[model samples]
Target: MDTSLLFWNNIISTCGVPRIITSDRDPKFTSELWTNLYDMLGTKIPFSMAYHPQKDGLSERMIQTMGISLGDHLNKNLLSIHPTAKDVHDMWKKACEKDAKCIAEAKEYNKQRWDKSHKEPDSKEGDQVLVSILNFNNLKGPKKMRDSFLGHFTIIKLIGKNEVEVRLTKDFSRKHPVFPVILIKPYFQTEEYRFPSSKKNPTAPEIVEVEDSPGPVKRIIKASKIRLNGKDQRQYLVRFKNQTADKDKLLAEDAIPDANLHLRRFRASRRTE
Candidate 1:
């Protein structure tokens, strides 16, 4: 795509220059060319987390409505074996207009919904904050094993109404420091906060891996252990019934579903046998 021409024709020529632009971290938008273009235009480009389109709620909602409109249009028209060009054009026009209206209504609905759960958060410069790690942590595993947020970052600046520029306390490798306010929460300092790890379960249950099939495999969880990694994410040590000698799998908490339920069932089955 011609970034300059498209920027000029679609954005600049129509609505004039924008102060800031938010977008997904797609390669096209994050490429050097677009970066330079936005820089030249003096537009701050804050990228959403990669693969997390929900971060761009407005655009994602519009796209969802457009998809539904396309499905509706196809259902109503695809059965017809033949149609004239004008007929097709009219049918598409009607569908487009319908989708556009739905999008407008949905936008208003979303704004109301957001207002219910979201208020303008207040943070001054240099305040410590915890940013929700929803978009950043995409690791597949049990919900219990995942971290809900990351940070305790130092706020550098408050941008507009609902965004902030932050500096990482531990890692400086991140390219962009700006993040949305929704993902950020205030971090209160307290003298009572302890740095020590919480007490571990005195009797950790043995966890076994069940084979992924209809047929029963005599797998039992012998033990489970959790530890924190470099990213401060929890990893699990799972030992299964009849596991190979001195061998256990290191997995994420999400790797096992309902560990307690599995263990209970296994014990119950053994009693019956």
Candidate 2:
């Protein structure tokens, strides 16, 4: 029989055709024949994300358990094991219930261990925080024995559960914007520990005018034409190459020379209509 025909025949004859099917994005599952057959049957198929086995963790775990059980049975040389479908189903259900209880107990124990000293941080959005360095094993010099936790970063947003998006304070860093709650601590400002002016956020008006400010003298990005005001007058946009440069500038073609000398010639040559 044809593969498509056999596949549908097995599904309809065995399980009476399921309404929803969850499977990995295997070639067979994504085949035109498989897709067309399911479409005609009005079945919904949800595929696991590519390269992420955790999405099909339940199936993977079951396969692992089956392998273990087969190994144990083979080692023991068990035979004459004949059981009805109902008997096997009952046994599996009982085992699943017992496993669920064990999992619940294990989770409770793990929660207690984590919560013993780890209080829920009262830090809110915009609160300054000290983020713990994940892998800091390079400390050797006497001066290098500084605080393990860097930052005083402002919390930009709270991610799902125990994660926050933070922007580094003081000097800038190219680290990840988001960090787990366990790796963060609320930063309290005191007389001994005043907030550094270098890290302080500028006024809203200044922030709004961020695009107008030119970044470091050394850094300059490619120029793009913004608009054409007159027949010969063109406005070009300048973007700072620096990672810290979030805002870009829109300047007249003539003013490019005064803004940055490096871009003056480049803008003159690469002017688009």
Candidate No. with top TM-score:
2
| Model 1 ranges with Cα > 4 A deviation | 1-114, 137-144, 191-273
Tell me the tens digit of each residue's lDDT in model 1 across 18-65: 765666677877897677777776776676663466557677667679
Model 2: lDDT of residue 213: 47
> Worst ten-residue run, lDDT, model 2?
75-84
- C-alpha lDDT (0 to 100) for residue 156 of candidate 2: 87
Q: Write down the lDDT of every candidate, Cα atoms only.
A: 0.69, 0.68
Candidate 2 local distance difference test against the native: 0.68
The RMSD of every model to the true structure, in order and in angstroms, is 24.0, 23.7
- Summarize candidate 2's per-residue lDDT along 1-51 as a digit string, tens digits: 266678778867787776555677889778887778777777767677535
